[model samples]
Target: MFRKNFIMSLMENILILFIIASVFYTSQSLQTQKTIYVPQGSITNIISQLHKKGYEVSPIDRYILSFLGQPQSGWVDIGAEKLNRVDFLYKLATAKAKMEEITLIPGETALLFFEDIASTLDLDASRLQHYYDQHADYPEAGIYADTYYVPFGINEEQLIAFLLKESTGQFQKISQKIYGTYDKKQWLRILTIASIIQKEAANTEEMPLVSSVIYNRIKKGMPLQMDGTLNYGKYSHIKVTPERIRNDKSRFNTYRYKGLPPSPIGAVSFDAIIAAIKPAQTDYLYFMKNRQGTHDFTKSYRTHRRNIQKAR
Candidate 1:
């Protein structure tokens, strides 16, 4: 009877141990679930703040994640971010590595550009603007004026560098296929002209033709009487009056300047750049925009004058 009693006691002890183990396991799982979404922070500088907020993470780990993620991590980005969710973090990290579409619409100023980027990716606009100011020469060339996909978490400098690299590659391929030549100085001049044309041209079909008109005028030593160049000078929007056209002395004023502008008016789209390089073969020397964005092109002064009269 005593032997049987001893065996029963041992069984009861084993059951109690099992219950304790199960309870411990359950507690651990619940803790994990509760803490999984702890916000480690979107900005690297805010990690300490996150810690203060009771997020259990090491600064070293956060730094490593940001460094590894680079352009996509701990930078000014667009998108909703949740703290400490492993799955969410994984998605963010992956997304950062991949390229995302960034649209730069026409008529947007530099400030608008920053806001757009920030709104889309949660990036710090002030940081980006700082970089832009310091490295004005960096984005000086080859930033195509179209929507482009850029890798996430990349700093502004790296993004601009990538753009320049891609632009150079594209320029090389196009030059080889069309003109069989690549001259940096000549291309810069062409890009400068193309940027102006891009802002002026309303119709894509007319881009190459308009480019031809500009080239013809340049070759003939006639002043490029473009309105866009003058508009670039005034901060406030003004009606294009004759006085404004004649008086504005900004270097961008092609009507006043004998040659191309000092720099591009804005980022030149690939199509515009290509059109500038390979303008349509035409004898057109003059063109003018109507109330509608479309331009009327003419080969002779008489035809141009007649079109102007009709426009009036």
Candidate 2:
């Protein structure tokens, strides 16, 4: 009878100890991103990835997660930076990330791009610029000109960081594929040429021809008198006038400057970038817009004048 009483007392102690441990585990804190990319996998694999990513997850969390439900695939909204262990586990299983689309057209300036984003995403323009200034490696073209589905409700800093990070990765990959290396200074010069081609080329097919004209002019030490150079920043959609060209003193005023712009005129397309890298083989140094709205290429200044007169 005494032995039976002793066994009951030990069982009670064990139950109390288990309750204390469970309470402590549930109260543990987990730090998380506002949105996290959860891979498509079983609970064990998800937990493993979380652990690998420096989260305070363990094998035991897999058992807890199994009871909650299957974790969502793709991006999951955690909704908070810090949460108790139980809440974090529940969110991983149930919450879905909300996304919105943003597009930056080729030849658009970053100034207008951010304005569009501010209107579409309900974000502050100044804050976006502040974050961009803080994190971007370049003043512009830090983000690729393409459509992106970003998580909704992301703050300015996170948004800018995300775009820059993704674009830099893509830039590195493209550069590596082309030259087996990535050099920022050389790449910036290429972007300068590409941006001009993007603004001047009437169509994709005309990109290489425009690129050739730029190279020839640069080689001959002639000023690039292209009007497209005046379309930088807030002047993106504004028509360039002779008055504006004469008054503008920025380095982007290619007519006033003898070489390429100090930086890219605007965002560029893949075709323009390729054209900048590999220009067409041609001796033609002058081009004028003809009546057909396409440029007429010529080697003679006198013929170029005739083509300009015919265009008028």
215-284, model 2: which lDDT tens digit per residue?
Answer: 9999999999999889998999999999999999999998899999888878877888889999998877
- What are the lDDT figures for the candidates, one per model? 0.63, 0.88
User: For all the candidates, what are their Cα RMSDs to the real structure?
Assistant: 6.9, 8.6
20-72, model 1: which lDDT tens digit per residue? 86455323311112122223346464455545655444465455456445224
Clashes of each: 15, 0
Candidate 2 Cα errors over 4 Å, as ranges: 1-95
Q: Model 2 TM-score?
A: 0.72
Leading candidate by lDDT: 2
